[model samples]
Target: MESLPHQYSVSVNAEKENELETTAPHLPTLLVAPPSQFDGPGDKWSPEELLLAAVANCYVLSFRTVAGIAKLDWLHIECTTDGVLNKVERNMLFTDIVTKVTLIVAEESLRPKAEKLLKKAEQVCLVSNSLLSTKHLEIEVVVGG
Candidate 1:
C-alpha cells in the first residue's frame, strides 16, 4: 500500500526594492526580504531567517505531536535555530543549521522520555528532512523550570 502525497504552495508579491509580501490562504501575510547585511530592509523577515525558522518550527511542532503520543508532558517548549551561511566558491548559501530545543517538564523522571521524543521529532521534521544542509540538534530538558 502507498500513501497519498500532499502539496503546499504560497504566493509572493514583490513590493518594491527587496521587499515582498508572501501569502497563502488561511495564513497571515508575511513581509520578506534579504537580510539587512545584504542591502534589504532590517525590519522585515529575511530569507535566511525564514529558512532557519522553518526548520525550528517543524521540529517543535513535530515534537508536540510525538510527545503527546509518547505520554511526555512538558511545561513549555522553546526552540531557537541559527543558520550559517558562507561563500562557497562564488555563491553564498546556508551551510548548516543549528536548532536548540529547551523543554521544561514537571518531573525529572520524564527527562529520558522527553529526550527520546526530541530525537524522534528531529527525525520526523518535514522541513529539516527536505533541507540539503547539515542540521545539528541541541536538546535541553529541565525539570520544573
Candidate 2:
C-alpha cells in the first residue's frame, strides 16, 4: 500500500550438507530444508511447504480486507491449502492447488455473504493468482459463538 511497485528482499545461505538459512530485513532468519519426499530430513520447512503457506496466508489476509470493506461480521476463518506436484513434460511442477476455507459467523443469515467473500478472496489472492497451477476453492460457513 505504500507505493505502486513494492519490492521485497530476502537472502538465503546454505553450505554443503547443511540446511538453508533464509533471512529478510528486520525478520528472524528461517531454517529450511528439502522435504522428505525429496529424501530430506523432513524436520524443517521446505520450499514446497513455503509456497503452500504463502497461498494460504495471502488468502486469509485478502479475506480480512474484503470482509472489512463489505462490513461483514465474522468470528474466525481457517484456510488450508494443498499443492499437487507432478512431472510436467520434462520438469516437475505444481499442477494443482486447492484451498479449503472454513468461515465462522455469528448468525446463519451471514452464510451467503461469507461464502461470497471467501470466493472473492480466492479470486484476488496475489500469490495463487501468480501461480501457473490450477486453483480450486472450497468454502464452508458455520454459525458459531
Candidate 3:
C-alpha cells in the first residue's frame, strides 16, 4: 500500500431519457442504469449491482494477498455475492449480504488452511468492513487435479 489514505474519483453523466455514462481516470467507461426492481430497462449495470460487485472483488483481492503471504498453492477461486435491499423505517438499505466462495487446491490437506484463509480474507475486506449491512460468507474448498 502506498499510504494510509488513498483517494478515488469517478464521474457519472446522464441526460433525460439517456443512459448513464460512468468513467474513471485510466479506466474504460461503464454504462449504468437503474435495476429492474426500480422499473429500469434492466439491461445495464446498476448501482446496486456495482456495490455487490465491489464487495466480491475486494474479497477476492484480499484472499489473493492473504494466500500469497501464506505461500498457499491454489488453482482458482470464485466468489458470488448477493445483497438484499429492504425498507427500514423511512429509509431503504441493504439488510444483508452473502458471499459464496469456492477455492480449488491440489491436495486434500490444504482444505483446512484454505478455509482459514478464506475467513481471514472476509475479516480483512475493507469494502465489507465498511458496510453497515450484515455480512455472511460460505466457503467451499475442493481438491482438484
Candidate 1: which pairs clash? none
> Which 10 consecutive positions of candidate 2 have the poorest summed lDDT?
1-10
Question: What lDDT does the true structure give each of the candidates?
Answer: 0.89, 0.95, 0.97
Q: Largest lDDT belongs to which candidate?
A: 3
Backbone clashes (count) for model 3: 0
**Residue pair clashes in candidate 2:** none
Error of 2 at 95 (Å): 0.5
TM-score of each: 0.92, 0.98, 0.98
Candidate 2 residue lDDT tens string, 8-118: 899999999999999999999999999999999999999999999999999999999999999999999999999999999999999999999999999989999999999
In model 3, the Cα lDDT at residue 121 comes to: 99
The per-candidate count of clashes, in order, stands at 0, 0, 0
lDDT of 3 by residue, 1-145 (tens): 7986999999999999877999999999999999999999999999999999999999999999999999999999999999999999999999999999999999999999999999999999999999999999999998995
| Candidates in descending lDDT order | 3, 2, 1
lDDT of model 3, residue 5: 91
Cα lDDT tens digits, model 1, 34-136, are 7888877778888888888889888999998899888887899999999889988998888888999999999989999999999999999989999888889
Clashes of 1: 0
Q: Candidate 3, after superposition: displacement of residue 66 in Å?
A: 0.3
Q: What RMSD, rounded to one decimal, does every model reach?
A: 2.3, 0.7, 0.7
Give the range where candidate 1 is weakest over 10 consecutive residues by summed lDDT: 1-10
